[model samples]
Target: MPLKGSDSDDGGNDDLARLLSGKHAGKHRRRSRDADDDVNGFPRLRSPRPRDEEEPATPTSRRFQHRRRRGFVLCLRTPTAVVLSSAALWILFYALSLEGGDLVSIVARLGILGAYLFLSIALFVLAVLVAVFAKGIPRKTRGGLLAGLAGTCVALLIYDHDESLYHHGGYNALIFALVVMPSLAVGAAEIAIWKWLGARRAAMCHLFALFVAIFVVSARLSRAAAIWGRGFGGETMQPLARTCKPTKIGLPWVDLLPAGAQNFWAGGLTCAPAAKPFSAEIDADGALRVKCPSNDATYIPLPVTREWPQDWKLVEENYEGKLPQPFNKRVMDAIRRTEPFRIRGDNAPGMLVPRTAEAAIVTCDGVEKLVLRARRSNDTSSRTLRPPEQMTGSRQTKTLDVIVVFLDATSRRHFHRRLGRTVKKLEQANADGRTRLFQFFRYSISGFSTGPNSRAMFTGTSPNNLDTVSPVWEDFARARFVTAITADTCQDWGASYNPRPAFHFDHEMYAPFCHADFFAEDSNPLGNFRGPYAINARCLKGSRVSDLALQYAGSVSSAYPDRNTFVLAWLLEGHEGTGEVLADLDDGLVSLLGSLDWSKTALVIAADHGLHMGLNFAFTRNGAVEHRNPMLAFALPPWLADSEGRGETLKANAHKMVSGLDVYATLRGLGKVVDPTGFDDPDVRKRAQGGKNLMEEIVPPDRLCSDAGVPQWYCECY
Candidate 1:
């Protein structure tokens, strides 16, 4: 298209040619331009000539000129391009997540393991098929692109699977910048290099440019990895409490008590003289929990750190070659999938404990103290009450005291909101300066209400299953340990699936107290219910019901100081009204803990779920949070508490999603920990198929809701 000669009459085109001809070429440019050469399709220009003699350029020629700047054109007859591009994107996404790229997908939110398998298997197969069958693109070009795709896939497959990545579903543009456009660009460079990338110097320049592009990509990837590491922990990944958006009061780091709206006379369990009067105070346990603490009596707590008693022989578990059973599908769906939960008690008649603690007192009427044993003989228990035949020599083994303090309708957040003082006091309690109370922030619920949830938690099976052989309490009893349970209401008893829990216990405080029904008209504190144990009914005959249970349990524990005991006190005062009333009972809780024989006591202060009612509608959304996020705190002495032993594992697991099954599993293992030969029976020695001990075994980071026996509907962690 250039002219052969130049003249004054050549016009503007000639002038432009004249301007560029001399400086554009080297000394040999004139000689070399005599003939046309397709050197990597690089354009060539001749010395200036007359414009009248030059040939005009055509559209095709103009288009061909761009060939040097572009690479191979990947023409396709089918949607091969679309398929490969899509696969590439998927591979990129996975790679970023695995390699800590900009688009890291957290295991908790993405169910990363399952999704990773899908991408690795499905996408990889699809890509291979496209590579083999697709037509139109050059073989070399196809091979090169396929190589890149395969490399990306392999790289992703081998990338470390770290569950620490917190959920952050953003960074889509990174995929384009990393894979899509760069792909097109690399192809162009390849085509230019393979076809004659100009002279040696020009080829080197193009090579250098490609190297720079690669360096930039590597730098970007490094930055992405850094971002991934920064927000990995549950504590580091700040929770976005959408419920607090309008109120600006849900920040966790700041004081959360004010958020409870406790200033309302309606809030916080008040200890003021009752507006009305009744009797029955100053019981010994009551004295320990209330009077003694109020009067500042010289507190003498039981020694917690001591060698195992010489009289009680220690038993050891045997597990030379055993494996835990896997959870099956049927149990996973015991509840619906993908729905949220509610925290409450449904309509359940009562438990099947013999005539209640009332019978022990020689009258159908209730007594202030109905003393009884916690474990019932199997012969007296219903046929459903079968324990793994009292795990070989369990009776001879010495066990630790296991006390469970269950707070109905209490969420972890609500625990913080209502019992901030208790939380602080427990946090301060320690073994050699290490924290004593391990709080499980990621604890989740298995049901909306009390019935099914209790069954799941107590039995470690589907909540729907009516019959269970090893209720945790029963297991303790079978192992020659004393077990007892006291509750404010019978509706939410752990074994609610039965019209009356099929299996009966040795002692019965719930039935006796509830059936006693000693109440002042309209005194119920639990909302509209006017009888007994309502959200608003703070006291029964002037004694705080919450403190009463604690005192009773303490008294029972003291009754058999020589033997290990398992007592559960289900407190309900903190069960409703934003649950702020619990704040008033913090002192009682501290006193109870102070009196415990920490040396042998392993306490679990947990809740089935939270009660979302009470307070203003501002907390309506916050109520949803309370629904699934129940309170789960484990208070163990330095020795047994660190069964994760190092504290590292326990601390890590506290952040991962935990459920009732894990608690059940932990209970099952206590026998082995306390009395060596305790619960290591052949059937249970391998651990329950669906449960895991939170303190001992580490829960897999990639564990799914189903894996933990949490139905999809009730699953809130992911």
Candidate 2:
């Protein structure tokens, strides 16, 4: 009831209420009252306006404004949160981009997924911390902190510019910019959000951070699912429905023989001709035109060649009239047992005839020459003679200078679709008359890593034993051939598993860097500047494996133009992350082939192993077969390609079951080197115990994985 200070108290409460509500609240209340005119079907009376249009400031509103300003100052002062958040974001970015780690086992591969999840969680915690600690910092301090962070980011960018992380004109630059810009923007936005939300800023920041973390984790999980799921379902090995059938071996002349001559050789002629007087000559059409005034004369077509006498034979004993009897007998016997021969009229008496000839004649000065020609079992009484059955020598040589190029980690699946241009170019070259010098074969059962496959190829044996392996290069070296092996990675050359001394190469050119160098420095992080992935990028920009191969090839061609050369150019561009360098590899191959004389060189373009990227749908979806399916091709010299239907043989056998061991056998065949394995029987070799020449009969369709020397763990052939 004491009314002494009631008026003062009332006035103070009114001022505090006005201050708490602010002028905007009064305006809102006035607007609400104006909208209630029709509430009782009568206009609501309005209060008279005060002298001042602005409402008086309230204590509550003023206190809130001061508190918001204080919160902004606090956020600006705490710079640690900003630094930690930015670092976390960068770490996440790097973790996602990491490459070159060997995920040999399933567990190791799944660990990568776990690592990504852990990183996302860590990023979320850092973001929430930033929101919580960034309340009430001063503006000047926040500015200073932001400026320092920006400077640090710039320094990092500069330091990574020359490194692999900053790939000019590549996706790396875009990725780097994406990571840096967003992170800096997020830091700046945190300060602004803090000032605006005041007490509610921390809660809102937590929600936003949660959303970002979930987004990143979901993205990573989805990618992991796609990659991991591909290898999860389906049978690991599927049986091939098609069966291998052996192709029959036939005489080369079958394609060239005339219909009438074929029929005559079949059974039209009768006994061998007796000694008689006759004349023999070759017509303009390269047919043997015989004139026997004493008997019926016949003509037989023959292949056109200037070296006639060497491939001819004498038929009659008395035809050696002017020569010694013993010499004539010896010559006749030799001719009967060997390749088709051409007779030199000056050396002996008889006229030139095919070594198959049972009888032949010559009239040097128009007088009848006593000679006899052999005949088939048929009794036509025709003077035409059949060549001896024992004459089986090839006119063209089978040997050639070999060039084996091993492209690293190139899967047949990748090359099958992507290398269309190269394949077309090769096919065109094969059809060209000038370049008819080469033939090609595509192998399908080519897979596995370089270590096992390469060893099989070079040593002509199974990869099961490394100690007893004998490099085919040794044979080439022994034959005075220039043997060269060029590689950028030590893993394929001088590493622990692959000793340098075991491999015999007249010239060895090793690249200064390899995958081993990536893990060489302990201070470097997984995908950092000094890692193998980064070094690979750097190595790609400089003199790469392809460059070394080109240099080695050029040197060999220049130094030993006449001597046969065997080059094993192992290029590394097809390995993971080095795919961008594949074009260079292709260019190097083109240059190498163009620089060499293909007439003498037999080129083999193959891969030591298939792509190990773990993304190939064929291998991943079916069962890890992609790891085993490498690319194999051959470009044989014209002499070998055209001889004994060899080009046809290679084409026919391309689809037959074969592996790197078969390649080894083919190499040995080309070089005429005997296998040290002591298994020389063609039938035994066809069983696939170790090596078998691809040019021979078809590899038996029933040949098992065990017979092929493939371990069960890696074998997919069922």
Task: Return the TM-score for each candidate structure.
Answer: 0.48, 0.47
lDDT for each of the candidates? Answer: 0.50, 0.46
In candidate 1, residue 79 scores what lDDT? 38
By lDDT, the best candidate is 1
- Over 4 Å off, model 1: 1-268, 271-399, 431-435, 464-469, 490-495, 499-502, 515-537, 615-620, 642-646, 680-688
Clash number for each model: 26, 37
Q: What is the RMSD of candidate 2?
A: 25.7
lDDT of candidate 1 over 1-718, digit per residue (tens): 3344645455657777766776576435533542353332334545656898755574444544564355334222233564566576677555544433222233132344334434544554556545644555557757876787767645543453222122111122222223334445555555556556557766787789889978966666454333321211113222323222222222222122354343243333443454422122222222212121122212111111011121111111111112131111111222123132111222122122232222121111121222222333343333323244433464433346788888877776566655756766675665334335566766777766665566666667655455544567767766556666676442324333433324445444543233223322122211222223243445543456666667667666665565666787877655543355566567768778778777677888888887644332112344555567788877775666554473556666766777888888777676556554445433253233667787777877666667776777666642
Candidate 1, which ten residues in sequence have the lowest lDDT sum? 312-321
